[model samples]
Every structure is written in structure tokens, then in C-alpha cells.
Target: MKAASKKTAGTIALNDRREICNVPEPSTTRLNKRMAELGMCSRREADDWIARGWVRVDGQVAPMGLQVAADARIDVDPKARGQQQEQVTILLNKPIGYVSGQAEDGYQPAVVLVEERNHWRGDASKTRFAPQQLRGLAPAGRLDIDSIGLLVLTQDGRIARQLIGEDSGMEKEYLVRVTYGDVAADVQSAFPRAQLMRLRHGLSLDNQPLKPAQVDWQNPEQLRFVLTEGKKRQIRRMCEQVGLKVVGLKRIRIGRVLLGNLPVGQWRYLAPQERF
Candidate 1:
């Protein structure tokens, strides 16, 4: 996306480090994007503030996707920060049969389980809920309908960007229950050492090599998988390559936050002090 000219609106082209760079094109780009590139907030939040006339560039109120130099000065009213502070991030111990985002094929989204009554009683966070909290709340990362464990949904773009951004490096840990497909050995003995090593380092999906993953046996039937990148149905596919069938999967952690004691179908707020 090219940035708009000084008088128009356009898109931003981000470099390898995600720094916004000016393209040679004359048209201007989206102002929300420029704000996001500056590390202030997500594009969605930027648009909200821009609509409210909370952003200014070069001493003038910013218009939608206003074109400016890559290094242009942009100022946001302090009110934006206060609104961002009220945005919430929710942690759910999503149960099986719930989709992480929108509903599909008659199955419900995990967010529907986040009603006030469903708030975890053991949660230490004191944040209370309002009907508006559910508005625009979205899953930051996906949890498969067949899986159970920690799933994040947030109204804060900063948290969403940190967890699922294209360049995010946060680690996600899972406990997967698998079974041997071959008849020669039970779950414990069927997998060879070489195959396990491949699960850790030597595999590719869709012709692209996979990033190194931490794959280890947790018990006779369970494997612990810690990965930095998520491809569609990645773990199950990796196990299939090793002649193993996944029977169950559960995510336990994301970065420093743990699934903890949040019961299935229940959710809690990410504490103000929490980083992930």
C-alpha cells in the first residue's frame, strides 16, 4: 500500500523491521496506518480516534488516511490513552466445540461463553464488565474447535498486535494427546528418535521449512509442543507425518500468562500488571 500525497489519503509500505517507509507514489495512505506504524495503537484504534478528531498531523486535524512524509510529526490527544486504558483483554479456558472467532456450521464462538456469570470465580483480577466490553471484542489467536485451553479475545489492538501480529515471536505451549497409528507399538514405543527429532527441527509444510519447535514427551500418551509460529492445524499435521494421530490437544500458556485454574467455558480479564 502506498502512502497518499500530503493532500490525500493512502496506505503505508512497511519494511522488514515493520518501520513505515515512504513510497515514491504520489497518493496518500490511511492515517490510521501511519498512527499504527508509530507504535501508538492498532489500525482499528487509530481509525476510532481519527473519527473523533483526536489525531493531529503538522498542527492540523488528521483526516482519514491523510498522506504525509514517513517521518511526519503526528500528535494524538491524551484522551486516546484514557480510552485505550479502558479496553480489556480476556483469557478464556475455551472448551471443545467452540470456535475461537465467528460461529461456523452451527457451532458457537468461544466469546459467547464470556458472560458475567461465566467469569471465573477464582480469577484474581478485579475488573468488572460492562455491556460495551463485548462490543468489538475479538480473538487474538485461534484455538481449534477440537481443542481445549487458553484462548485470548480482546478489545485492545495493542494486545492483539503483540500476540498475532505477522512478526510476533511470542511462544505458545500446548499439551497434546496422541496415539500411534501403527500396530507394532503402543503410544509410548512407536515413535522413533529420528522421527521425534524431525518434529523438533526437520520438517516443512506448504513447501516452507518450519521454525524449530520444542517437542517433547510429557507422558506415555501426551506430548508437549511449544511453537512460535502457527500454521493451520500445524501440530496435528506434524504428528501425522510421524505416523501419530492426535487424540486431544490443549494449550496451557502464551508468553508469560498461564491458563492457570480458569475452568473450561469460563473466562477472566488480563490483569493491568500482566504483560502478555
Candidate 2:
């Protein structure tokens, strides 16, 4: 069962095409948080809907951030569903030198590469390019300006929450090329196995324990890492702890979706049938 279905009762919002499932039991938590827990929307989006009187509890408009009972029947206005339908998700093979969120110091943001001309010809999605698709679109998860690979940008709050929310469980896989300073020393031999163990389970960042990650050597100079959480330049920091320097990094997949041959600096739509 989904975590949100623990105690709450849910009904599809009127006129909604997709079932409004996953509404969480209120259980004394803030209303915005409850909506996010249910996978309804991100907390920020929930707050916006509540403020607009687009959210309801037991068929009545909900008050902003109100705390309520576990069994409250939460509902969203049809306008919310309409708004959701307009959202789009884009996948990009980000090349180095472009920031994920915004431009800085003369460097452009990766979204600038999401132009009509950059749409991959092999994309199976028949959705035509529209300037409106760029409106309100933001990076759901960030990739370092120095790294390259799959970078997700979207207007959908649900997709954003699914990938980067506080409680998200989606996995991101990356291939990294590393250097350990000594030209003749192999990283696997020079970097102690115990440190690898720490990379898998014992490491912490910002005074909090990092979620366990899958880290293993892909080749003599490359490592494969799969992580459930992202911190600022996390992999690079983790490598530093073990005396390894990350020379190159490329995200290969997010959840079940692979970046697969999407040329750098190009993008494609996230197909309707794909979930992550």
C-alpha cells in the first residue's frame, strides 16, 4: 500500500481524468503537508491551491495549513486538475558548463537548451513543441554545472515532488570518472575498501547521516553510483572523503527511465506511460 493511504479516505476530485489517489490521512499534520504526503501535489502547490480555495475537506473548501483529522475526505477543485493537465515534464542530456537551475557568471541555464531545435528527433512523444511548454518549467532535480547527464525539468508539481521532495524514494544512477592523484595507483587498490563501506552506509553530510547509497567500481577509473537522495554536489563531496577526485560525472538514469543516447545539449518529453 502507498504510505499516504495509511488512514485517510480519498475520492477523485470532480472532473479529474486521473484518479486523485494517495490523499494522506490528516492525522494532526498541516493540510499542505498532508496533500503532499498523498502525492496530490508539492507542499508549495498545495498551499497555493488552498489559498485559492481549490482544496476541500469533506466537500468544503479547506483553510490554509489547517490541521485536521486522519479520516477527512480531501478534495481538490476541478481547476486544480485543469492546471495539472497543462504541466509538462522534459528530460535533458545536460552538457557541462550550464547550471541546472539558473545562469551565473556568464554561464547559461540548461533550460535554454530546451529549444524547439534541440528536441531529439528520435523522441517517440508526438507532442509538438510549444513556447508555452517553457512557461513555469523548472528543474525538478539539479545537476552540477560541471557535470553532464540526465537532468529533469518540469512544470508538474507531482513530478517535482516525486523526484526531489523531502520524502521522495526515487533512485538516480550516475557514472563517474575519478582520479586519485597517483597516476600509477589504481583507485580500487589505493582507496581502502573500508572507505567504500563508508560510502555505502556510514557517511554523513551537513551533520546528518546520508541515506545509504550503491557505490561500486565500474572500471579502473570509473564508478557507478545509485543514490536515493541528492545533496549539493554530493558525489563529488563523497569522493573527496576517500581521496578520490571526480573528473567527470554523468547521470545515466532516474528511476526506470534511462538517459540512453540522448545527445548532450538535447532534450525530449517524458512519455505519458513512463513513471518515476
Q: Which candidate ranks first by TM-score, i.e. highest?
A: 1
**Residue 163 in candidate 2 has what lDDT?**
90
Q: Model 2 off-target regions past 4 Å? A: 1-27, 51-53, 63-66, 184-186
Over 1-276, each residue of candidate 1 has an lDDT whose tens digit, in order, gives 234363243233233224435334445556787677667899989988988999999899988767777767889899999998888999999999999988999999999998999998988888887889998999999989999999999998878888998889999999999888654235667678899999999999999999999999898788999999988899999989888899899999999999998898999999989887
Best by lDDT: 2
Model 2 TM-score (2 dp): 0.83
> What lDDT tens digits, residue by residue, belong to model 2 across residues 9-73?
34333324343554554358788888888889878889889999999898888987698676779
In order, the Cα lDDT scores of the candidates are: 0.87, 0.88
Against the true structure, candidate 1 reaches a TM-score of: 0.86
Could you tell me which 10 consecutive residues in candidate 2 have the lowest summed lDDT? 6-15
The per-residue C-alpha lDDT of model 1 at residue 26 equals 49
